[model samples]
Target chain A: MTPRARREALTGFLLILPWGLGFCAFTAGPMAISLVLSLTKWDILTAPHYVGLANFANLWHDPLFWMALRNTLAYTVLTVPLSLAGSLTLALLLNRRVPAVSVLRALFYLPELMPTVATAIIWTWLLNTHFGLLNYLLSRLGLPQVAWLESTTWALPSLVLMGLWTIGGNRMLIFLAGLQGIPEELHEAAALDGASRGRRLWHVTLPLLSPVIFFNFVLGVIASFQVFTPAYIVTNGGPADSTLVYVLYLYRNGFQYFQMGYAAAMAWVMLLLLLAFTWVQFRLMQRWVYYEGGATPG
Target chain B: MRSKWTSVLVMAALAGTMWTLGGGSPAQAQKVTTIRMVWQGEANELKLYQGLVSKFEQSHPDIRVNLETVVASSDPEYFQKVQVIAASGDYPDVIYGHYSWFPAALAKHFLLDIDPYLAKAGLAKSAYFPTAIQQFSDHGKLYALPRETSSIALYYNADMFKQAGLRTPNEYYAAGQWTWNTFLTVAKKLTRDSNGKSADQPGFNPNAIVQWGTVAPVNMPFGLFPVVYSFGGDVLDPTNTRCRLDRPAAVRGIAFLQDLLLKQHAGILPSQAQQTNLFANGKIGMMASGYWDIVVTGSAIKTFAWDVAPLPKGTIQSTRVATGAYAIPAKAPHPDQAWTLIRFLSQPDNTMELAHLGLIIPALRAAALSPEFLAPGKVPLHRKVFVDALAYGRLDPRTTHWAEMVDTLGSEMDLVWTGQKSPAAATGEACAKIDALLQH
Candidate 1:
């Protein structure tokens, strides 16, 4: 290589050196160690004992593992599409020219900015069966009270409902950005062809918004699978392990139960599952997701 | 490029110098040993601990105590932090943790065997309550020494009994008539609906209770185990290797609670917040909890007149006991100093101070029964009931996998609490789960 080219390359490498070093040291190094640790029998307080495939094998018989996985999948399946739809609906509404629209946007986004610990505590009271504001309102409307966090059947669904409160914030902002990026000419052309406003939205707007929905869908599903703080703080993964999401169970095994190796194995399995789901979503995305730049060959 | 490399080398050298300077000087490394202690407590309790540390440090001029408290939001978080600290191998010289925690910590060999220190200090197992010592020991090896011990007792709202024209629990105890049958009858009478109709009255609405008769042992095994034991059953078999929750006595005990909460409506099933301060809420006629509740109830109940009494006899009177103890890790840097601090903190005077503050019942028999501890202050008038209950108090079962077992049982028990399953079915399922876990 020429001297000038070598000098430029060396300078570029030096600039990124700190980030590269940090990634290798903190993230990659620990991930590699966790991979090795999953193959052993290690409580945090004791020396790790080599026990090939034992921790992974134990997961098959562990009823709690299966229960947690089922709860996590239920959460993901319920949350992702609903959150996407809710956020997109909010974004479409906000995308209109309205009085104090900026203020309204910030107001809607406020729940996401609040700390999760505080949010969970607030929801705990608001969901209380006898005394909570929600049930009080229902009673005022002449409806029967429903046990929320207290009932095993309702606990997971209650958490899903709690999660919807924040969808008007971050995901809606993304949807808003996606909506704004859609060309007005397409909608105008549809209208000129005598299409109804609803038809124009169905044909032009939704197609353009599909990519953003897909992105949010993938992220929402991933986030839902790792639900921890609400279950940890509010229900403690109970009324009967009904809200025992995957990450919370992993935490119980690793920290509360002191079975770090088993927790590592659970973590690895979660990562693989997430990867598999994301891959399937991406494959399906080819059929549904649309791009404006004509990037996809017909 | 050359200047940048030169500057990097200079920065590295300066960092090295700073690190070297940060190390203690050779002259500073003498016989004054610093013992690091990790503890968990609320503000007032920690202040008391800090004060005790200062006094201990004053007495032993050469020993310095350094406290590192982890303000645990919950038990699981506290255990997680302790395990992480233990894993780092930079263990504190001493740790103040729950009795339930020691079994799991001991199983993983995180805690040091305090037997040698106990021998050196000329202390015997008799120094503490038998249950306290037993709870902290595993396989005949002691890992910790009790700082305080607590046992459950019946606490009743005095005005509720008086207004209902019913005999008080302590009065019944004095008359030697405080059996479960009499207790239940009294409970039924005291329980009133919104229309002031007693539980036995026709058309009494269980759904709209104005006053609950009692608060059943709803959450902890500490609360439930005593009733089961009173009926001559236990959570685990005698070997502690298999669950005995499905035993007839346990089923009977649990079924009694289910009937109270779900059928008889003598007790209301409380929410999580209600459970914390249920006795003080004035809606319940009676509740059973640990001796530690005296402090909380004393402070919270301003309008109500309350007192404690022995838990009414079931098949036989029984209660579950628990303790908080100071343990040293296996690789602690200053074990001797840690032991000295543990010994000093557990002295009679210190224990009396703690008891006076309504923090604990001293584990030491003499201290527990001292005038300062027994004297009536702001709290329950019948504090002696706590000491009396100890005669029938049994320690919670401690297996190597205590946390896992408790969690499994707790989940199944929740089914019973929610009325989705019978006590027999829930306990049977719990036994199966626990049996599988123990075998694992």
Candidate 2:
């Protein structure tokens, strides 16, 4: 390579050195240690004896492990598409050039800025069985009041319902950005062809918005799968372990139950599952997700 | 371009040096030793400890305490954070912990033996409550110095009883009529609907009740076990090797609590947001909680007279006993200094000063029995009941799996409380889990 090119390359490498070092030390280092620890029986205080795949073997028989995994899967499946649709609808409504649009956008994004703990606290007050606002409204509608967080049947669903509180949060903001990126010319052309607004949206906006939807769907799935704070702060995985999501159970094993190696195994399983999910999502994307640059003539 | 690159390299070195200097300043050119003490307490308790720590520092000019206050909602959370801290290989010189935490910490050999220090200091074993001392000792060695002892007792609202025209719980106790059946009868009388009907009244509405009878005692050691014990049942057999909660006596206790909540509609689960601290709010007749709640709940009531009473008799009157204590970690950086802090903290005068906070019944016998603790003309005029309970109080069954066992049982108990499972079914399931835990 020429001297100038080599110098430029060296500068680029130097610029990324700090991040590279951090990624290795904090991320890669722990991942390596946790992988090895997963094969042992360490209780944090004692020496870890090699236990082969005993932890994973035990996981096959552990009821709580399966319960947590099922709860998390159900939560993710329920939350992702619902949140995506809700946020996209919100984004569509807010994308118009209305007066005070910036203010409206900021208000919609406010819940995302609030801390998770604060959101959990507010949701608890909203979901209280006898005196909460939701039950009060339900009673007004001549419906029987639901014990939102206290009943096994309703606890997990209540969490899913509360999660809709963030539909106008960051996911909506991303969709708004994606909507703004779509050229106005396409909509105008469709209108010129006498296509109705709904037709234009179906044929033009949706095709262009498919990429953003995929992005948000994947992120929403991952985030929902790792749900912990609300479950921990509110029901505490109860009314018979109905809300025991995977991460909270993993935390219990690692920190509370003195089963660090088992927790590490659980963590690895979660990672592998997430990886597989993302890979499948990427493969499926070719069918629906449209990229302007990738749409080449056959 | 060369000068720009040179300046960038210089800046990188400068940042590196500053980072190193910032983190490396703890140890310096001085003879003074700073021993870290990890503690968990509410704001007032924290203030009390800070005052004591400052006084200790003043007396021992060479020793400085770097106090680390851990904010935890429960003892298990405190232990969890401490365990994580220890696993990181940065051990605190001293740790303030509870009896429930002792078994797990001891199982891991994470605590220092304190018996030798006690002997060297000429501290007599009989100076504290036997149960308090017994809880901290294992395998013929004391691992922690007892700090404060506690037991669950009934706290009743006297104004509610007066308004209901029912005799107060203390009066019932005085008349030897305070058995579980009597307690239930009184509870039914005390519980009121918004329509001014008591729980037992023909037209009373359980759904629209404005006042509850008691805040249910359905927690671990302090709440649930006492009821189980009072019903003449055991959580585990004496050897602590197998679960016995499925036995008839325990089932009877569990069934009694379920019936009160569901069928009788007299009690409400503790920690329900709408029902929380109902005793303090003057919306409940009675509550069963630890001595610590004397201050926690006592300070909140403004409209009613409330007082302590012994837990009503079941087959027998029994309460679970527990203690909080201070110990030096096995790998403490300054064990000698930690011991000095513990010794100063546990001195009779010092312990008595802490007891005045009303959060703890000082483990020091002389201080506990003193009028300061009894607090004559106090809101809870029956302070002596807490002291009396020490006579019959049962320590939680010793086990290395205390946290896991309690959790296993608690989850099942939740189903029973919700009327989803019978007490027999819940206990049977809990035992199935706990029995396996015991084998581990």
Candidate 3:
């Protein structure tokens, strides 16, 4: 090889080395081991004996596994879009040249900065049926008190509400970046053509913001798929396992039941499902998600 | 500059590799062995344990005890984590485990058979409480050493009983009239609304009552087990290999508890957040708690007068005597040192001193009955009830999967208490699941 080509190749390898090593060690290693583990019947102690898809076969008939999956899918479907909309709405409101808009944005985003445990604790008190502030206010206004986390019907939604509280930061940041990226000339041209505010937003603002919206949607979907901590700490998958998310069940299997092999299988299944969902989202995005410059030819 | 950067990166990578590889080696070779001693206790109790460990280290210069204490809230999770570590063949020499955990640990062969050590130490089997010792033994092999034993009792608000013109629980216990029927009557009398109406009164709104007659933290399996037993129920068959909670008596026991909450409405069902605070604030009159609550809840009960008495009898009188024990792991690197620590902790004098501090009821009968440990000022007033109840206290049926059974039962019982399912239905469901679990 020529000296210049060798030098370029060496520099390229050096630049990529740290990330490449990290990817192999952290991500690839666990993925490969988990796949092997999924086929075994090991607790933490005994030697892992090959069971050959017995764990996956068990999941087919496991009622609790299906229930947990349904609950998780429901939570993700409800939370991701609702949170994205809430974030975008707040972002639009703050994008204007209002007084102290930055301060308002920061104030709105503060809940996301609080530790998850702290947020959960605060929400537990707020959502309590009898003694909670929410019920008290509702009663004062002559509205019926809702059992937020106690009733099986309300428990999952209560957790969804709690999860929504932290969306402000993510939404605000993404929206701000999207809004700044919108070309000023388009808005002025829309105004010159006597376009209404709604028209301008629908045509210019939304199309320009599609890339950021897609990015946030993908991130939100992935994060929402692994919703475990709130249900774990606050509800403990209870009032009859109504809030038992997929990851929470995986945790129970791995730690509580000492069924690590089963949990490993559940994890890989979850990864494949998420991967498929992301792929579908990307495929569907061809119709709506517009690039600023142009769509690349396939 | 390029050479310096490359060298730095290489050195960092090497250092990281070396750090990872070197970690597990030095931990094995440390001559002054650091034994991780873990237990669940209050802050003060932990402080006392630390002091005792320091004393222990002073006496044995060659060994060092690395005290690892966890709060009671995290005790179950910590126990599970430690068990996982034990399974991984890297367990501490000594561990503080609940009596219920002994069967599972022994089943897994994770606990060391300490009978030989006890025999060598000249510790007679008769020295400890018979029930406590029997609970730690499985199939003729003693797998653990009981550090303390506790019994469930009826803890009452003495001031409320007085105001309601009811006799103290001690008087009833003394008269052998502390039956479940009389207990229910007293609960109804003491259960009053803010408008000065008893549960029997015409205008009494159970939901709107400001003060409840009793509070049973229905979550604790040890507290609930006796009620089931008293009603002529058993959690498992004679061999403890099959579940029997679906039986008529067990269903009756569960139904009675649900009636106390839903039908009679004699107690408050606070939201999960309010349960602990409500009990501590004297909003509930009586709660069936363990002897350890004397340390946990007693310190918080300065608002009103509260004392414990023997739990009221059901069809057949019984109560649960739960204990926490010290066990050496089967993989313990220093078995001799672990035994020395267990022997020191289990000595009568040490047990008495510890009990006098109100940590728990000592497992040694002599230490428990000693005046220094049993005196009124040293231990709380309600503790005597636990002492009395020990005569009738029954050990939980030994099962290798007791923890899983408890989790299932506790959750199902919660459903019963919440009026979501009938006692019969919940108990039947739990039995089916438990039977499946046991088979596994």
How well does candidate 3 match the true structure in TM-score terms?
A: 0.90
Give stretches of model 1 more than 4 Å off: A1-15, A296-298, B1-30, B138-141, B272-278
Cα RMSD of all models vs. native, in order, equals 4.0, 3.9, 4.7
Residue A166 lDDT in model 3?
74
Model 1 per-residue lDDT tens digits across residues A39-97: 99888877999999999999998889999999999988888888888998899899989
Docking class of 1: medium
Note the residue pairs that clash in candidate 3.
none
Per-candidate TM-score against the hidden true structure: 0.92, 0.94, 0.90
lDDT of 3 by residue, A37-141 (tens): 999987665678899999999998888899999999999999998999999988898898878988998999899899998888888888876568988898789
The residue pairs found clashing in candidate 2 are: none
lDDT for model 2 comes to 0.89
**Candidate 1: pairs in clash:** none
What is candidate 2's lDDT per residue for B280-350, written digit by digit as tens? 77888988988988887888888888889999999998998999999999999899989999999999889
Evaluation by lDDT, superior candidate among 1 and 2: 2
Which stretch of 10 consecutive residues in model 3 chain A shows the poorest summed lDDT? A289-298
Per-prediction interface RMSD in Å: 2.4, 1.8, 2.7
Compared with the true structure, what per-residue lDDT tens digits does model 1 show for residues B158-269?
A: 9999999999998998898998778788888889888999998899987666677887777667668888888778888778788998999999989988887777878765
- Candidate 3 falls in which docking quality class? acceptable
The reply for model 2, stretches above 4 Å from the true place, is A295-298, B1-31, B273-276
Q: Per-residue CA lDDT of candidate 2, range A221-276, in tens?
A: 88998999889988788878899899999998988888999999999999999999
